[model samples]
Target chain A: MRLELVKRPQHSALFSAVSPFIALALTMIAGAIMFSLLGKNPLDALYYYFIDPLRETWSLHELAVKAAPLILIAVGLSVCFLSNNWNIGAEGQFIAGAIAGGILPVVFPHVQNVMVLPLMLVMGIAGGAAYAAVPALLKARFNTNEILTSLMLVYVAQLFLDWLVRGPWRDPGGMNFPETRDFHPYAVLPELMPSAGRANWGIVFALVAALILWFVLRRTLKGFEIRVLGQSPRAGRFAGFSASRMVMVSFLISGGLAGLAGISEVAGTIGQLQPSISPGYGFTAIIVAFLGRLNPLGIVAAGFVLALSYLGGEAAQISIGLSDKAARAFQGMLLFFVLGCDTLIHYRIRLAHSAPSKRTDVPQPSEPAEVA
Target chain B: MLESILITIATAATPLLIAAIGELVVERSGVLNLGVEGMMVMGAVTGFGVTVTTGSPWLGVLAAVLVGAAFSLLFGFLTLTLVTNQVATGLALTLLGLGVSGMIGEAFIGMPGIKLGSIAIPILSDLPYVGRFLFRQDPLFYVSILLVAGVAWFLFYTRAGLTLRSVGDNHDSAHALGISVIAVRYGAVAFGGACAGLAGAYLSLVYTPQWIENMTAGRGWIALALVVFASWRPWRVLAGAYLFGAVSIGQLHAQAIGVSVPSQFLSALPYLATIAVLVLISRNRRLTMVNTPACLGRPFVPAR
Candidate 1:
């Protein structure tokens, strides 16, 4: 006996739309089983994991804060992924952005001007874009694999950041700790409402970025080029769209956003350059990009969902004594289920007695026949 | 002093050689598993935990291999049976491994580990320069060399290897020839997983002999890059691994010698070298394309 995936004549749009929900449902079921195995009450664990995080005003603010970076990075990643350009080193770009944005506050700690914040943001974007261009240039000029190159850069960026904080950029009066001095008031990102919660302009930046990306991806000719080029580069070439140019453009956009996210994280929340600023936001955003089905608007919702999981993970850790590792495993499981369910959007799984006899409908040799 | 440094390089290179060789086979069978780092960390934690519990490094090694293989099976089920996107599924596998291993290893953290002691072959071990570097190394070091030799022969000389390569080169043709592409791929992926697990075990059991969160660090990723750097050849993987090992160890040595470069920059050397080697090797498109698994990363579904 064998099982096979038969390609659908046309992908089910409805399933494409609903697949994320299906995946989330499956993940919850799996999470329940995991909780049971861990000897926790499944209902209580589930509530803490999914619902409890959103119940409070403060938690909701935290959710927005966490979601800001994910949405920004995921939005950029959606553009890159859609164009078949993989930029797995958004983490590196994020760090670069933070480092770049921090130069003003770190080097000129006494500066106090309104333009400081705006200039820092621009520098952050530029830093990220410049860093991303390394892999982009390599892919365009030499056809090197972006996945490997981009990922390798992540470690480099990390080590560089570690070095700076521990050495050259270390604060003079920080009591020997490996961190920079706190940003001045003019350099810091002001909170949205000082009295309410910790949420700041980062969330606002995420929303604006999403809206702009949606317009660019859906209503513009460049958007059409990206969609066409991503689906079929050959077709894109015939349409006069340069794949190499798109590679650069997609990478720059993604890297720029990632950098923006990094600086926002530093200025808005951390308030200082440190050894570890991100909690894998760049990598987590990859999940968000896919979860949102690589759509900018969809990414906004997906970002919030993932952000909630991070908060829930903390909650579960405190309340049920669930290990942080378990929370990560839960996230990984969600991604696995998401990818599996996504397969259902384009293919139908069926049991077959044998391989050769079951695949008669597809006459084209180019199509994948049986996935068993 | 030089011989000791060489020994350190070899010890560092062993894990990479083992992991890359396993991945080489998986890629030869046309499946690209990007979760090597995740699997390696899973192995590191599992091996440490088991060794600490059982008081036997062998059991720890065995458990690590099993855990790694099991993790790969999850990947196989998704990519092979469910026909999920290989890249996405591989990344998910990695995330899952890191998370699960972290959870399982929480208790084991800070616990002292028993190292897998080196073997000494009497006169050979006592011999001057080459003695400690070769004959007196840990059992896994010799195993890694043998594994490389065995894989090189198996890939180039055996009929089964031919089938695996054919499956990787073009799965549809291999399927038409009754190669059982899916079965071969599953076996290959499992083999890769087991090797990755063994590498992880080497880290905790021999390298550091203690449990540390993410102790494997980015070595798993370096292994993946080594496979590409070798252009899918076993001998080249051996060379690449050792080169990487030297660069990694050399950085520490440089820092110790006060090379004036920041220790952080020195620490970043191995990763930077990986990028450089990739760029250099990939510059020649023909060489890369020739040895490259033609159907690599593509989801294979057997049909008539």
Candidate 2:
């Protein structure tokens, strides 16, 4: 059997709205089959993987904690992607942000005040943006492929972080652990509701960022510029929009957000800089951005869904002896479905057992229209 | 000692050469598959698992190749048939490959690996340093060299190769002339997948001979860089691969020498080198513009 696609006269609004949900449903079905193949009862695994994590108050807090970074990083990514600037190096920027933000508490341990937290947050945004600018500058100046350059920077960032914690930032008084000194109370991000769980102001920041970006992307001229440039560079050029300038704008926005996520994760969740601060949140945010359909508001919801998967992975591991790695696989499959389902918005698919019949009775798409 | 080091460098270079050559062909046919890392890791895990289970290194290599090609079909289906954004779809493939490979390789971790032995050509193996480097290397090293030459010939000399290149340069024209653009792309993608799988197998079966999670590391991405560095030429890819191999192996040797520089700094050299090479190559705009496949990464739907 061969798959054939027929172009629709216009983009399907129904599919545009419904594709994500269809993708999610398809992912769940695939997950169920995978669970059964692993010798677990499909229904039980499904519940544990999806529903059980949301059952309790503390787990809900955990979800908030996990969702914070994904949402924060993804909203930024939404801008970069919308502008057609692929910055896959947000993972590195996250690390750069963590290191930059931690410099305050790690190096200037005596300067504990109300100002330190805000200062650290600013430093983080600066650090992430600076790290991301390497690729952006290279692309703007030399027309380098941002995807490969950004990705290579991820490894460099990882190594840089490793060197920092193990070399310069190693806690001198601590037992030689590869981590920085714990943040003083003033430096730590305050918890939202201490009695419930460890969730902090990070979630609030994430929501605000998403809300603000949603407005900019929808209600502002800059948003229109990003959309126009991304959809058609030639048209953007004709409209006097500089693609290079847009690259810098989108990259800086995304990188700053990713950095904020990084510092927040460090100061709020871990309380210090360490050898590793994320569980692949930067890379995972790429999936989140796509799953969210490149809209900041959509990213907030998508972020929670991805967060649930991380929680579900841990839950399944403890309860059913499934590998936590399965969660990553599940997320990967979700992105595949998301991309595949998106095809429906522009084309209708037909499964043909033989060559597509060119029956004279069937109406055909008129001329090729001189596609460029 | 120098001979041994050279051999190690060759070992390191082989997989990158093989994978980059395949990708060069795929790009020549006008598809940019960013899933090489994903497909390569899947290959590594499958190869190690099969070799460990069957105790036949050859069979392991074969399984990795097939699995890699099969995994790539997912990418091919989404990007080619479904006409999804190629960049996004490629990233999806990488994510899925990493996730699925990690799950599949979980069982194979910590198990002893069976290393594939080098083939010794009679009499030629007896020569001093050059013989072992050239004749007594593992089977895939020779395959890597042959692949570069074969791909070079196929891409530049063959009628099918011209057709593939034409499709990459102008798919609409190819379609106008009744060439099956999608079919050619699918074939190129599968070939790239098979090469990536073989490269992954080389990692597990010969290089380290173990099933380590994310073992391919960033070599797959490096291979992608190599394709650009080579300007889509197969032989240049060989040169680029060997250069990277030296940088990587030089770092290892530096660490062994107990150089004052930190190990992590040394470990980061290859990635840094890739960035440097990319900057240098791309700085020459004419070089890139003249060689780049015109239709690379663009989604094509034949309008009837």
Candidate 3:
């Protein structure tokens, strides 16, 4: 008659390790049902979505390309989320990074030097960090909710980028289209290997960032402080850790990485700044961060898995006429299952025929409750 | 010109007021659902799709409310029943809504929608400058106003409102007092969803009268912020929504008038105003603390 979640004395480490796979399996089942409802062959649709993308060498390279920005952003987000700082405006930060990094090539087109690429990277990092500081400053100084402020800034950043590409930064010979001029050879991120595919240094950046973050999170004193602060702010304060400072640090790291991802996307893949540079990579990274259990190395794997879904979505669209919305829905389903499975890891579901009568023993259900 | 501008502002503010009032009640009941945007979009698509097919705006409005309520039920299951992380689950609901709506709305894109026409109240509608702006408007506009007043009275005067507020203020205390915390929260979330859906329907049936992918854009998010800006008060939500509506429409006027500012800057005005208001309000910590649901965003688990 009634169902309840009873917290476990200790979460099973084995289940925690295996939960993502269980979630993935459940999502696949749900996706199959969805495809059937859409009047498509579920097996063929699933294959195109989950298998066809990885069959080609070129698609594999494309997977890496898409995964790079996701991994880079998710790595930073993992730090922020782990430290109890929610930075939902990574999309804005990414755009700001792209804008900041593109300034050199867009403004002084004649500049040709080896320093251009390095300077652009620095600008991208600084731009993202500076943009992130808005919410961070508000949260620290005025106690404004970072979740809302950070999210609100995303719209501002998006509109700002739109203005730049349409008005001032529009390419002179672009036929009045909303986009910036393409970067010169010196400014562009070089390909990792011309013979293989279009994959570039961004993936390399993602890997290195993941490695560095893993070390910092697992081995450093600062990492311990972040963990302590996240678990209990009161205890963290007693241990001489400042919540305000941690907010700034986590935001800067997250924002800077997100910015780096933005610039890398422009310099490496897009080659020119446009009204829409990302296909929701910043937002998708939030899913990646959670899927990875807020672990840097785990995020690397989660990033690739999500990237595969994008490729699969495209593949399904071509093969079985799947709508882009279906792909997004599938991703959403994956996140839901992931959260659901994670809940199971922490609490066991119990069904009781009769409701309890006392407050001390599993607070009594007033009536028969449905499972939603 | 001023009257027309006022009408436009009122039209824009209507959906916001409806949605924010719903969220205010939900938040007051101690559940924070960030899926407003997702629910709104779902409402928009469903409302548009149904109107296009059924040829009746009322049916479309009804369909949207049901869809919104259904969508919120998913959130209720995950948060209240499954006891999942509220923030993550809410975000998931949003992603699902956007994706599912997009899929369902693919065929409806570019199709003209049936409008929910304005109601003309004879003499009241014919009054000089205030006539059309106040009396002659879409049925939903009046409903939004009534919603504000009704919610304000219910929250302040009704016993059910007090119970909901108590449940939100401290779930543990409310639980001990035999209040069905989960049931009250489910109702609150469902109400929020219905309001969000109605807002979305207003967009498709009255605002634009056509389906566009992500047509709700970020208004759902803006609605969420408006709740905080209003500090969870129904009347304050009305003022905040109108102010936001003015800022949003004012930016377009500025662009049309060729003000020195770039159109993009003007476009960002509403969001900027939200941040500014948040900063100003949050500066007075006492105000936020007093009104903010103490159990907001926290998972409620009954112990044995």
Candidate 4:
């Protein structure tokens, strides 16, 4: 039998609410199968992968730490994706932000004051926005494909980061390692509740960003413009929304947020600039954005879910000797199911035995007798 | 030494050429499968694994092609049959491919790989320079060139090619004309996947002859850029691939010669050159618009 999708008269609200949950369940089933194939007890592996991490205060803090960047970056991506601007190079932007933020700590270790941290955060956002501007400017000026240009920059950004930590930014006091100097106490992001765990203000930043963006997207004209431009550029243009300007606005917003995530990751988690600063948070955020259905509030929840996968990967690695790469594979499968289930929103899928007819130019659906 | 460098450049160019040509057809048929990187990597791992276990490069190549095509069918089923968002689905495919390949390839890591030896035409192998360059290269090298020529002919000169192009240019019209838009897209996507697989196979069997996680190393993406750089023309893809191949190999040579510049800068040349070339080409809006498929990246749902 072949699958046929009949368009629903309107988008199904029921499926819209349930698809993500359905997708998550499907992923867990697939993960269990994968674990069994690898010769582990599927039940135990699943528990460690999903439940074990949530039980501990430290792991929960770790979850917050991981989710902070994802929520922040994905919230930004939600804006870009909503506006029909595909900024696939957020990874590069994240690295650029980290490098930019690290400069204060690495280059000016003597500037150990409250002002330094604030200045570094500003610089990080600017750096990411500046990096993202390359593709935005290219697209606006030259009608270039932003997807390719943005993605290409990711490699450039990565290499630039590699050059920095190894070259000029290397910690002078430390042996010749590839990492830069550690941030001074004043430069480090203040912890949220150090007594409880290592969670910092990064999660607070993520929540605030999400709440503000949610308000903007839900209750503001800018959100309307992004939706209009995304669905129909012609309609958006007719409505006086400049597509080119929107490109810049959306890119800047997303880039700035991605930069925030990068710096937060460095100051909050890593505490130094290094040859590598992120573990593909930018890329993972893309998945998070989609899984969240491009809703800022939804992204906060999705971020925690994806963060759990990372934690689960680590937990599985320790307890079951499963490869950490399995986590990525699991994530990839999650996205596939998410997208597949999203089909339920717009159409009713039917398993049919065969086509009704082989003839071309069939009559309208209203003429039911023609098919028979 | 010059001949050896040329050979290396050709080897570098071949994978790009193969992958781009395949994607060119896919785009010409109006589907953008962004998972070329993913498919290529999967191909590399499968090719390496099969070669290691089965002891034949040909078998390895065959398995890679089949696996790539099979992997792409997941995309086909999702975007084509289920009508998921092509961009998101393609990204999913790539992410999944990378993750799965990394897991599978963990076993093959650091294992000595069996290289696919070059072809040796009895009389041609002995010639001073051009003969070896032309005829004494690996089998896939000739396949790459032939693919360019064959795809160019098939796309520009064949009736079937016209049908595929028409589908890409306007799927609604094609569907109205009784052509199976979805079927044609499935075929194009599969062909792209197979070529990507072969390119991945080339990497593992011929280029470096080993399994490295992410060895495709954004080459699949570079190949995607090459398609746009070529403006969907098969012949131009050949030129663009070599241009990139030369840039990449030149950087390697530069690093080997120990140029004062940082090795990272030298290594980043290919990606930088891609941006430059994209800017130069995309500056001519008229050219890009005229060549790009009208229905490219737009999902199609046929009405009953």
Leading candidate by DockQ: 2
For A193-280, candidate 1 gives per-residue lDDT tens digits of 8788899999999999999999999999999999888877888889999999999999999999999999999999999999999989
Residue-wise C-alpha lDDT for candidate 4, range A1-372, written one tens digit per residue: 878777777789999999999999999999999999989999999999999999999999999999999999999999998888889899999998888888888888988878998998999999999999999999989878788889889999999999988898888887999888889998899889899888898999999999999999999998899888877787888999999998899999999999999999999898998888887899999999999999999999999999999999999999989999999999999999999999999888987777733435432221000000
Indicate which candidate wins on lDDT.
2
TM-score, cand. 4: 0.97
Q: Is candidate 1 or candidate 3 better by lDDT?
A: 1
lDDT of each residue in A296-339, candidate 2, tens digit only: 99999999999999999999999999999999999999999999
Candidate 4 stretches greater than 4 Å from native: A357-372
The regions of model 3 sitting more than 4 angstroms off are: A357-372
lDDT of 3 by residue, A235-304 (tens): 7899999999999999999999999999999999999999999998988999999899999999999999
C-alpha lDDT of residue B304 in model 4: 74
Worst 10 residues of 3 chain A by lDDT: A363-372
Query: What digit string (tens of lDDT, one per residue) describes model 4 on residues B6-33?
Result: 8989999999999999999999998999
The TM-score of predicted model 3 comes to: 0.97
lDDT, candidates in the order shown? 0.90, 0.91, 0.90, 0.91
Q: How far is each candidate from the true structure, as Cα RMSD in Å? A: 2.2, 2.4, 3.1, 3.8
User: What's the DockQ for every one of the candidates?
Assistant: 0.58, 0.58, 0.57, 0.54
Retained true contacts (fraction), each candidate: 0.71, 0.69, 0.71, 0.64
